[model samples]
Target: METQNLGSSPDVRSKNESVKSVDRRNFLRSAGMTTVAGAVFLAGCDKDDDMTPTPTSVDLGSGDVGILNYAYALEQLEAAFYTQVVATPFSGITDAERSMLTDIRDHEIIHRDFLKAALGNNAIAGLEVNFSSIDFTSRASVLGAAKLFEDTGVQAYNGAGNLIKDANYLLIAGKIVSVEARHAAAIRDLLMPNSTSFAGDDIIDAKGLDKAVKPADILAAVKPYVKTTITASNLPTS
Candidate 1:
């Protein structure tokens, strides 16, 4: 329950304005778009696990709203993941594991709802997911899948930030990504006890920044889970 407010923690609440400003400005210029010299980071900071079936196939529209849809899709997947993980907990799951994952599930659901409220009608349909690939009863399988989702979700938010021109959306993305990072770390520790796989070179760079993934790449990674064809061709580039 304590981790429920992970985003509000001092580490996550603090702004990385200097780093983000340079990256965002560079991204804008590279994309041949306008620029905001010193871009300010938004800092705004929430529960429940949703396992309901949302829309199967939905278009991620375009513009800032589309980016929101992109995030919503990931949140949909994550919320479902932790929901199932908690609902049908894996064998040998520790009480600590369940508590932490339950908190994560609540965070994801809150994220999904946040995006929905933010996007309103502009939001895409709720995604229907297929979890047949995962062995819900196996701790290894569950934690592995959780790691993938959390890490990818973090990267997705990082990449999608450049596409978002709205300061409000950018701020929200920052808030969510920090929590995702927390999830990634917690799950990673569970998977490899006392190991440093949380921020391993595979995901983070030498500079210690999480890699940003393109929308196309992100859709590909989660494609097998969702039966729909995610069309992100119109999303902003760079």
Candidate 2:
């Protein structure tokens, strides 16, 4: 597959100098952490439609590769969304909101780039995204979408934890998920200031745990945003 460079906003381009100055080994050591093209799914294809041509299927290989690609896919979507958010700056966006969203955008870009580098040739092709449902000019629309993506990401990492077989991969995943959880909380607070919505009953369970959605469900929910048809048939089930 051809390696596709996910385009960046001007801000991301400007920061490239500082980002490149960091020693790669040191960055990977401290971050252990953390693509675009269409949105991606772990292993399932969207429902077939007689009226539409079948979309090309990109397989996420099994084991650690599948998991990493799964994450790469989400990061790609997030980076794309936030890049647009920062570039356009929704109507009535406050300075605080702009700064916060810009930070999130940079983080997502880092995550996406890290995963791509880690996967190297194993990574799937860049995906095509569809953001038609989102009204970027509207604050409520953008923030609402941000909240959904962040929350869903937290759940995805939580649920996929058990599926990861490599100890090192699991450790890196843990680190990444913590950051994602923080993003979710921050977005929530922005949407509902001074309220219990940050850890509200909607996402928090009676056991004081966040929801851990299965791969199939997560893919289904995010399918609309992605224009590519991804196949996760090889993902670990047990």
Model 1 Cα shift for residue 179 (angstroms) = 0.4
The lowest-lDDT stretch of 10 consecutive residues in candidate 1 is: 1-10
| lDDT of all predictions | 0.71, 0.72
List clashing residue pairs in candidate 1: none
> Over the stretch 149-207, how does candidate 1's per-residue lDDT look in tens digits?
88889889988888889897788688778778877876665565435876878788889
CA error at residue 16 for candidate 2, angstroms:
34
Question: What lDDT score is found at residue 147 in candidate 1?
Answer: 81
Candidate 1 stretches greater than 4 Å from native: 1-56
Q: Tens-digit lDDT track for model 2 on 122-150?
A: 98877678899988988778888888888
The top-ranked prediction according to lDDT is: 2
**Position 43, candidate 1: lDDT:** 9
lDDT of 1 at 222: 88
Clashes of 2: 9
